[model samples]
Target: MTRIGVITFPGTLDDVDAARAVRLAGAEPASLWHKDADIHGVDAVVVPGGFSYGDYLRCGAIARFAPVMDEVIAAAGRGMPVLGICNGFQILTEAHLLPGALIRNDHQKFICREQRLRVESTTTAWTNLFDEGEEIVVPLKNGEGNFIASPDELDRLEGEGLVVFRYLDNPNGSARDIAGVRNQRGNVVGLMPHPEHAVEPGFGPDSPAGARQGVDGLRLFQSAISALVGA
Candidate 1:
């Protein structure tokens, strides 16, 4: 089975959900501790969301130096797929694995709601299962979800089609409505939404049929599994 590692930091709250999402996607989920330097040979890595280190010192600022992140950074450089969700996305940017930074919301308040996002690109490993221009709804919860970047960097991201997912409603004042972005090699992806929370049917976002029937986020985990299998 394809094994995916989910790293748990000191204050991580979504590691279990991430692991469950991996299992639902037909991959074995391995628990990786923040203090560890190895990934246990997993095919891919997922940096799940949560208030790592209690969100002290600017969200992910401190978690970037975790021992597990060292291995994650190296493995991602070697072409191993890595996905960072919400606070995890912050850490990726702080670690320079992905571009841009996530700052506090414009309203300076925590926001939690079902968010609509458009899949801008399917070239990344975590998005291959999605169709280009597809609209997906998932749960989004964060205080520091605002994504910001320089004009030049934003232009480069747009020019290279590196913007993976874009918010349809512009919830957090992210640059160009970017909800997610992938690195140049397309192996690393970071986004400010909680896809894992919407992976299971009957418990995710509301579907067209009714409430809590959406499984749109499941494709992300499945996409990674498929990518690893193809690799």
Candidate 2:
């Protein structure tokens, strides 16, 4: 079975959710400890959303240097698939795996809602199942969700089509509506939304048909599986 590693740092609140999402996508989930330097040979990795290290120093500042991150960074450089949600996304940036910083929302208040995002890059390992320009709804809860980058870096990302998701409702004042981004190789992706929270149909966000329709998040894990095993 394909296995995906779910890292848990102290204060990580969503590792279980992420693991459940992995199972729903038909992959095995492995628990990876923050103090471990190894990746346990999992096919891919997920640094799920949470207030790691109690959000001390900065949101993900302390967790950025955890032993697990060193392996993650190296693995990502070798083209291994990696997905970072919310706080995990913050750590990726602080670790320099991706380029940008997530700051407090424009209102300086945490926001929680079912967010709508437009897929902008379908070539990434984590987004191959989504069509370019397709819209997806997922849960988003965060204080530091506004993504920012230098003008030059923003231009480069736009030019290279690395901007993965753009918010349709603009809840966080993220630059250019960017809700997610991918590395140059498209194997490492980081997003502010919590896709794991929306994976199971019955338990996720509601739909217009009065039935839950938030299973859209499942495709992200499936996409990574496909990329890993060429399924």
Candidate 3:
């Protein structure tokens, strides 16, 4: 089975959910500590959501220097797949793994809701299972979810097809409503939504039929497993 690593930093709250999602996708979840230098040979890595390092200094500024991140950076440079969600996305930007930065929400408040997103690209390791233009629902909760980038960078991302997911309603004032993006190599991805929270059927977002049905996020984990199998 493909072994997926979920990193746990101080103040991280979603590593367990990310591991569970990996398990549900038929992969083995490897728990990795922030202070550890080794990644334990996992095929891919997930930087789960939470206020890492108590969101001190900045949202992800402190956590960017965590010991495990060094290994993650090296692994990612070697073409290992890395998925960053929410604060994880902030860490990715702080680590220079992906472009752009996350800032405080324009509303200046923590927001939580089931969000609608349109898949803009499926070439990334984390999004390969999704179809282009497919709409999905996932949970989004964060205080610093606003995505910002320079005009040239935005144009570059668009031209290179690196924008992976786009918010339908522009909840967090992200540039071009971008909710997710991937690195140029397509092995690293960062997004503000919490896909792990939406992977389970009964416990996820509710559907129009009053049933709790938001398993759309499961495909992301499955996609990583598929990519590993193909590799």
Candidate lDDT values, in order: 0.92, 0.92, 0.93
lDDT of 1 by residue, 104-177 (tens): 88888999999998999999999999889888899999889999999999999999999999999988788899
Judged by whole-model lDDT over C-alpha atoms, candidate 1 comes out at 0.92
Stretches of candidate 3 above 4 Å error?
A: 206-212
- Cα error, residue 180 of model 2, in Å, equals 0.3
Residue 156 local lDDT, model 2: 95
Please write out the lDDT profile of model 2 over residues 1-231, one tens digit for every residue.
Answer: 999999999999999999999999999999999999799999899999999999999989999999999999999999999999999999999998888999999999999998888999999899998889888888899999999999999999999999999999899899999999999999999999999988876777754344447687888999999888883
- C-alpha RMSD values across all candidates: 1.5, 1.5, 1.6
Q: What is the lDDT of candidate 2?
A: 0.92
Per-residue lDDT, model 3, residue 88, is: 93
Against the hidden reference, what TM-scores do the models get?
0.97, 0.96, 0.97
